[model samples]
Target: MKPNPISVVTFDLDDTLWAVRPVLLKAEDIVFDWLEEFAPKLTDRFTAKSFMKWRWDIYANYPELAHQISQLRTITVQLALEESGYSTAEAKTLADQAFEIFIEARHQVLPFETAIPMLETLKQHYRLGVLTNGNADIFRLALGQYFEFSFTAEQLNASKPLPEPFLAAQAHAAVNASEIIHIGDSLEHDVIGALDAGLHAIWFNPDDKEISADVTAKYHVNFYQVQCLSDIPAVIDTINKSRLHSRVTSP
Candidate 1:
């Protein structure tokens, strides 16, 4: 069968392009340190580690925050400040400023060595965009120049492994689902989710994690894997060529 030629390449920002955990850990520390100096009562009441746990607690208690990551963060900070004895207005202002500090630090990511070069190559032939559940603003980072658009869970009102965000991306790119390829570090959110939504997927497994055989057998169509960032464009080229060969040989 002739492949639906790929046109739009969508990426999941967080762990796919860079190590998100370290970035988040550092951002958390920055936020807490800022709070320690400006809102000492909050720091006195809770350590940075405890503050992180409280943030998760708020996320767990509020189902509505599943897609509103920024709001969840802000609310967590505001509530902590209020509990630490700040007035409502003061807490709100402090929370907003604290989140700004966190996000700025969050953007200070160290991408893998070949990430930029790979994006540069891919962007020449494909329309690149971002689809993420996290708050990693691509435009805040140097790599944002390559992406044509970015869709967050907060903006789309749905998060992966849900199909809504994938479908929304397909619509936004004005391309058939089969013509789009989503690359991410997640098995469920990136590979299965994209395949389930009728788009292709490339699993960006830098750690070379094992995948259960059953998972692979289930969604074999248009699913691929790559351990190195530089291998992506080549794999994509192969997908198209193999499909073309199949088209020529089919009886």
Candidate 2:
């Protein structure tokens, strides 16, 4: 039970740090506008609702590509264009261009008031990183400086709430599970994923909703729950201190 010194801190993007729903809604609107002007054949054939359904169908058919949302979206756009009578070459060019615009708008995010400040503070002590299932480009938003590295489900072909990406992060950081802590908003995705991979977890439940992810009693001690950004450091400190004391007192 020796105190495991923390070396790396990993986080979730999207709702954990910013309001992603608005960002995505605006991003979708921007993409829709771009498509109407630049790829009208595709737009004329399908409204936004059906366009979204086509995107969903892409994932449903080829789930092995689940983590690669960017690619899936690009493929969906290309299919829409081709189905609307664009030639193969034209469809490919339009899809790639449209996807570029979509992603550029996607990273345009507004962080929570304390989110960046807390990251700045943590960067002073730990090697911070991001692990996200979404196609968010932190580097595109000038937030890259805060993270030492990022693990995207897009690159791994595996998403979180599953242990592949989390274990991959553990290997990349070259630290034991005890030496790392993951913070994110989803009870199932961040907390359960981290614990399943043998790391400590801090649930960033900002809404303070009742815990519903089914925590069996034995695993409770490995969890830390936080409602506000400023509270994270203290909770992490408490875990470290508890581990140190356990080491000291063990027979």
Instruction: Count the clashes in each prediction.
Output: 0, 0
Off by over 4 Å in 1: 220-222, 247-251
CA RMSD for every model? Answer: 1.6, 1.7
Model 1 lDDT per residue over 146-246, tens place: 99999989998799989988988898999889889999999999889999998899999988898888886787555889999899999999888876787
TM-scores vs. true structure, each candidate: 0.95, 0.94
> What lDDT tens digits, residue by residue, belong to model 2 across residues 183-232?
99987888888989888889998888776445746566678888898888
